[model samples]
Target: MTHSKRYQHRTIISFFTVLIVFILMAGGVQAGIEPSKVICRVETDRAILPAGDSQNVVLKITLDAPPSPAHIKRPLVNLALVLDQSGSMSGTKIQQAKAAAIEAAIEALTRLGLQDIFSVVVYDTNVHTIVPAQRAGNIQSIINTIQQIRAGGSTALFGGVSQGASEIRKKLESDYVHRIILLSDGLANVGPRMPEDLGRLGAALIKENISVTTVGVGTDYNEDLMTRLAQKSDGNTYFVESGFDLPRIFAAELGDVLNVVAKKVKVTITLSDNVEAINIIGREGRIRENQIEFYMNQLYGDQEKYALVEVNIPKSTSGSRIKIAQVDVTYENPFSRKPEKSTGISYASFSSDSGKVARSTNIEVIREYQLNLNALAQEKAIELSDQGKKKE
Candidate 1:
């Protein structure tokens, strides 16, 4: 061949080589940029998985820290005030409880400026709604109802909460933040009184986009029950040693309720056909075939919520990339009063070479995984010690 023809042939070959390299790297690139609503990141411990092996994947979802008061546009609130009026809550505790409720009600009337709703239910042996849900215009009537409440009978903690929830249901609206704030200074001694029952009830309320925050005043209340109820409902739990602190805790709960930015947040993670989702660690989620779904009642101004999914991988050929899972989030944006969504995908490459897998390890994922393991170990140790077993 002539020299000029040879030079042109070499240039053509180099161009085709570069094109092939780009095509190979394209699969490693992320599908799109992260969503603005949340910081979602999917990380695997290593980039390459061994054939026929399983791996754990962590989804780190975070919202920016709580904004300043001036920056947050408070939403309309539908609040249920469930107060314990048993004999144990007499004197200072009951007086302080009434004060807290009044303070919270006054703030809603003066500062929120929205069409906020309020309901009051005080419980003893029986539960009754002192004030059914209404606009925050009747401050005098509410104060009178609260003052009439006198502590005497046995505690009907469950009954009071259920009655409060029913009151909020009467005026439930999509735009309003629905919440039940329960304050108790005594154990539940009447009606269906069980921690599991309260937890299940709290979980059911979350499905209706309502969260329950619990406040335990004094040491007589069941801390375990209070915490479980709040956790199941994605709400806050507070403990007050002094009755005087009731007002502050109530105010803090009101602040959190008004600062809600997103509601009805749902996360769905679908694993690829080649992989089987084994289980979800830490958080409770529903599993349908290979997909996992989690329902969150509300997302506050600053919070981080995440789930870790473990998957089993089928054997694959070397130098091939496989999609691990696709995560989609749907939420009601309070600012826009419309539904918004974000999507992300996770991928892992397979390699026969062990060295490549070692080099591609994601340090962040490994560190997090190790930390989770450490936590689990500590929990197990505590459990064993509680059972009267030696550490060794």
Candidate 2:
């Protein structure tokens, strides 16, 4: 080949090599900051009745996320702590719970800054106030009140919850993160309402923009009821098997509760005419009337927070589709609501092959596990009934 031709060929090869390098760099950048989607699971089970006439169906939804250090801030917290002073919590349980409450209050007072407001509500047959809505400066007094509490009488879990929620309702007007932290060891035995009725009451409180977090201390506690209460109120539920675990759980979560970055964050999806149905499963979605609402359950100090929602798409024959889900977040601004507006939006496209959007596996597992447990419980109940008949 001539020298000029050879030079031209070499130039072409270099051009293609440079193009490949540019493409590889672009791919790496895309991989580094890939968009994430949330997942939610729903599980159900059916059990035969004693007369073999009907079946009961139980449903559960589980929420989860990829493991990461949670971004936390000192929340403007208005907290009402409803402690169980029932007969079962008399000795060590009451002592440890009191110690945990004191530690939580002091930690919030010192670490969460002075903006945090704290309160204490202790209950046995009835709810009593230790410290009403007050600033962190009075945390020492609250701690002293916790120490003075003693366990007695039957458990009035429902009454305590209702009273705590009422106290939180008073603080709802303030631009604060309102919450009630309930610690219990048994089912409701003294309240006029049933557990389910109390759950509905808690759900109503959630509608008023208040959340309730429940902690079940010890194995005898009614875990199912506590879990449902948290779920209904858009709050978190924790199980403490021993006293040793109380301090850390309280310290970590109480800090997060008090210093919330956003309040009343909600997401709504608007589908095109072709789309049929949308289901959101996880800590994210709550169905309210015609629209589904998603709350930002946890917030790191930063302005940005993460949420996941799963959409089910029906197969379409048309090569093109137009469906949009808008994520709208409404957060309380410490300042003026007009100047510092409380809303945000993120868009998801159904056509994108990029795996930025997908279903959540944690939701699926939670649903299946709950369903299986429900089925097992029903079977055991039936077996016991048969055994009693045989003895007769």
Top candidate when judged by lDDT against the true structure: 1
Mind sharing the TM-score for model 1? 0.74
The best candidate by TM-score is: 1
TM-score of each: 0.74, 0.62
lDDT of 1 by residue, 198-275 (tens): 999998888777889998877889876887888899888999885556556655776677667677888888888967
lDDT for 53 (candidate 1) = 55
- Residue range 54-133, candidate 2, lDDT tens digits: 22222232222222223322235667777776665643432343344444444433433454455667677877866676
RMSD of model 2 against the true structure: 21.5
| CA lDDT of each prediction against the hidden true structure | 0.68, 0.50
Task: Please count the clashing residue pairs in each candidate, in the order shown.
Answer: 0, 10
How well does candidate 2 match the true structure in TM-score terms?
0.62
